[model samples]
Target: MRDLKPWLALIFKRPGRLVMGGALIMATLLSGIGLLAVSGWFITETALVGMLLAAGVAATINLYVPGGAIRFFAVSRTVFRYLERVYNHDTVLRLLTDIRVALFQSLASASRRHRRQLTGAEWLSRLTSDVDALDTLYLRLIAPTALAALVTALVVALTAALFDIKTATLVGLVLLVAFLIATIGTYLRTRHLAARQSDCQESLRTAVIEYIEGFAELTAAGRTGKHAAWLMRQAHQVTSEQAQADTLAGWHLAGSHLLINLSAVLTLWAGFALFRAGVVSGPVLVLLPIALLGLAEIYAMLPDAFGKLGATAASASRLNRDCQAEEPARDTGAQGLPANAALFATNLAVKHPGHAPLFTHFELEVNAGERVGILGYSGSGKSTLADVFSGLLPAAHGNLATRDLVYLTQKTVLFEDTLRANLLLGAPNASETELWRILEVVELADRFAPEPDQLDTWLGSSGSRLSGGEARRVALARVLLNPAPVVILDEPFTGLDAGTRARIAKRMDLLLEGKTVISLAHGPDALPGTDRVIHLPG
Candidate 1:
């Protein structure tokens, strides 16, 4: 539960909305109970008056006051209920927006390796399903439980005024016992099951995503049926857990219902005895039973609300574990890079967590306007070096400094947006003419020129609509648009054909003439012109 503090704080960050929502909920419940009690009294009084008139007994009874009171309660209940729903839901939506932004920022600030371990599907579940579960925490658990408490108090107070203190004490005791039984019993029975169900659901989500993403590979390997069977088995487990929770919830609801009805009956019987003894009025006797009925609106939600406790807690725990920010070690008192050098590094060391150092005591320097190639085979820390240079990964020990630079990774990642939108990421204020110039340098302008939207064409998720080579070019064009003085290309020409690679290389030389470039690749032929080649030690 301690893990939930941060998330809970976010929900209550704007206390005004929470308080207003709670006040409205209380008003809704009170109006509903008032309506039921007044209607019951009015009916009883009217019946007695009708009998008196039939018997030729003079009686004075005004229907206008009680009738008007009933109307006021009914209308207020409806109005307050509508207002409560609208305000609370609007507040919840705004709270969810804040939560999403906070979660994204936490992820962005997390260690690169940690972020890498979270697959795209896992992220989608956290951002959507986990966050959605939080809504139930406020609406179902907190609001309903708090309102139930308030309703119980009002019930006791009303009983005391209409009857004796002893009777009111008994009523309060009965309500408290019933509520505790319903809430605690439901929680103890369903908490583990709810947690298991949530886990199974996440597992099923991961399985379905894998099956879709790897459909071609699984089919080719003749393992698609096996994966599908596993997914079905997971679905069956989830359904089985859900059935157990539902069954337990049903039992709890039955028990609570019986207890409430018994309490109401006991109260009415005692009041009826008093009425027969000429100690209580007939209208007052009718009011006790109907008042308990009004309380049904509050206690009715207890079983389901407590049953959902486990699922909500599980989601909160998962989100807290994943989204908590970890501040990286800062390099204090480190000087800025000199204006004359593009990059400088000395006694550099880099390592992954719980692993031996990938590189140690590495040394490198590149003068301004120098095109350098870092040649290395796989597992030789080529990409790690790029990460270090781009400040994506911190150094274990080193003095490293560099001017602001744009990095193009080996994988070309593009969002599901327009071509123009994707390009704007590199240079937000770039003009159309500048965009066309960069595209021409990458040799993709002609391909897009014939299109209706030109640069406005929408690129599917990760640029799935484009061929591998075209995506690479689009990424390169984006890099070219960056205003940074230095650019790091990690295997920039990976997917291009030999002809296209040569053409892009020649064009890159012309376009990036005076900028410092660090091209990391397997061989020297990747970048056409290079001032020096530094081979990484394996």
Candidate 2:
């Protein structure tokens, strides 16, 4: 239950919509009960009046009031049903949007290593299935449970007034037990199975995706049969859990119905004693019994909802765990940085969590408006150091400070959007001329200029439409467009031929004249123009 606190707080943010939707649901239920109770009263009165008139006695009955009420209840039931569907569905959509936005923001702030621990399929489950489980928390669990309790109390109170305290108390007890059977009992029976259902689904989804992705390799190795057998078992387990949950919910639903019907029977039997004592009229006797029976409609949805409550809590727990943000260690050197220094580092240590330090007690400083390059081979800690300097990954022990900067990571990433949109991420207000000028600097203007859509051409997923060098250049163009005081480029000239790299490197020198630059590459040929180069010991 504690796992649900954060998500519950988020859901409660839209109290106004929740209140309105609950009111509509309440009205719909009450109208349904009223319709049945009043119709019973009207029919009994009509029959009694007819008997009296036929016996050579005169009788008078008011048809207009009950008839009008029946009509009103009938119409309101339809209208409120429609309105509830429209309004509540809209609320669910808005809630989904809120949840997705918060989730993405949290993911953005989380440690990259933690996020990388999850497969792509697991992340997809969190975004789609896990989020879906939460979006309906109000409609499925909260509102129905609350409205059922309230409506039951109202019916019991009415019974007390119309019949007698003793009868109403007995009827209330029966309905209370029914409510528990539908809600608490259902949850208890299905909790373990339901809680693990999401996990099983995620496991199955990951298995299926892995199987498809590795189908060719496994087939070539003559191991596809074994992998497929494992997938079958995983899928079967998921199906078995679902079936068990459904069976439990179904039994609880039937039990609740039985108890409610028993209450109606008790009401009828007790009404007979009251009628013989001339304590209540015949029509009134039938009314209370019919109203008791009407409660079955509300309790019907409770068992299924409670059955899924365990799953919802599990989903919330997973989301909360995955999105937790760990604050990085503060850089104490920031306040003492020299005015002319673009970057300052002291006693720096670099490593991933649970791994030995890659490099420690290292120090470096770059002055403002200077070009400095750091050289290291493949196995060295060059990229790890780059991450620490850029603040993507925190250092084990370090004091570091940097002026505002833009870092072009060693990996190239571009969205499946228009080329213009991709570039705009770096500088949203960059003009067309500025864009063209940057592309020309990277010698890519000619490549895209001949395309049908020009700048608006689609980049495909991760810029799949472009070759390796072209994609690398597009990423470079974006980083260069950023107006930061310092620039960190890790293997920025990757995939470009030597001739192309020389041309771009020369052009970048003039373009970056007024900003400090820190570039990392394996050797001097791979580096751009630099005032001085630092080599790390192998």
Candidate 3:
């Protein structure tokens, strides 16, 4: 329950939608029960009238009222059912959108170290399956449980009015037991199994992905057959556990139904006594029993939903752990940047948590509109420093200040989207002409211009449609598109040939004329044209 608090808060954000959807569901359930109870009463009334007419005794019955009510409930059940499906499904989709947006925002704010600890497969499960579980939280678990209790109370109260307090109390007690069997009993019987099954499915997904990714290596080592067999066994175990949960849910469902039917039988038996004593009429006697039977429809949904409750909780726990929000500890000693400086750092210590400090008492200042380069070897913490300056990472101890900036990381990242869309991420309001100009500056305009879609050409996943050099240039082009006063580039010219690097570097000066550029690279050759350069010791 604690694990579900955050997600439940998100789900309840749309209170109006949830309330309306619940109303529709309630209406549908009531109409179905009303239809059944009224039909039974009408039939019993008609039978009594026919016998009275056959015995030559006058009898008056309002056929029109009962017939009209039956028609009304029948039509209402169908209409409400359709509306509930449409409205609730739409609400679920909107909630899904809200949840995904919130999840992504939390992930974006999380530290790089935390994110780095997660595998791609683990992230996928959190985003897809875990988020998917929360989307149905309102519709599946909350609404049904609440409405079932409310509807049952209403029905019990109706029984008291139609029959008597003693009989209603008896019927209510039976229903209470049936509700417990369907809900808590199912949950207790299958909670561990369901939670374990959810985890097993995730593990299997990760295993299969790893298996396919390492298939060639496994074959080379002659272990492919063994690994494949292990995956098969895991998959089979997941299926078996799912079967066990379903079996338990089925038994609980059967028990609940049996108890519900018994309640109906009890009502009918009790009603006869009341009917004989003139405490209840024949039509009223039939109505209570039929309405008791109508409760089967509501109880039918409880067992299946409660059985999966454990899995939903597990999913929420995982999401909360993975994407939990954290506020960085602010340093009171930190100072603001000087008016002329684009970036300033003083008494800075740079390192990851629980590790040796990379740099202590580091001091640096770059004036606005200065193109400064930092040169170091591959393992010299050049990228880490770049991260600190760009604020992607925090300094372990120090005062650090920077103007608004855009950073191009050491790794080239491009989405599976159009070429134009990828570039627009840097500057959303950039015109097509500006996009083509940036592409030209990066020496990619000619490469894409020959294609039919040109700017609209699809860049496959991670820009797989382009060569390594081409992808690197596309990333560089995106950074260059930003209008930030400060620009941080780490290994900006990676994957490009020397001549191409020189060409892009030459054109970069005019493009970034007014900006403060801090470019980190492995060697002097890798550094672009700079006003001054700093070299870090090994």
**Best by TM-score, which number?**
3
Clashing pairs in 3: none
TM-score of 3: 0.86
Task: For candidate 2, write residues 99-206 as lDDT tens digits.
Answer: 888888899888787787789888888888899999999899999999999999999999899999998999999999999999999999998889899788888888
lDDT of 3: 0.91
- lDDT tens digits, residues 1-538, model 1? 5756778888878789888998999999999988999999999999999999999999878889999999999999999999999999998888888888888888777768677667888878888899998855677777888888888888888877877687778888888888886788899989989988887798789779979999999999999999899888889888888888988988888877776777688788778777888878999998987888788778888898888778878888888877766665534112556658888888889988788999899888788899999999989999998988887777888878877789998778898998999999899999999999999988989988998999999889999989998998899899989989899999999788888899889988988889999999988877667889999887
What is the per-residue lDDT of model 3 for residues 194-215, given as tens digits with 9 covering 90 to 100? Answer: 8999999999988888888888
What is the Cα-based lDDT of residue 117 in candidate 2? 77
Ranking by TM-score: 3, 2, 1
lDDT, ranked from best to worst: 2, 3, 1
TM-scores of all candidate predictions against the true structure: 0.77, 0.84, 0.86
What C-alpha lDDT do the candidate models reach, one value each?
A: 0.85, 0.92, 0.91
Candidate 2 at 237: error in angstroms?
3.0
lDDT of 1 at 476: 89
Candidate 1: stretches off by over 4 Å: 118-121, 211-233, 269-280, 327-344, 349-358, 365-381, 394-407, 417-460, 463-538
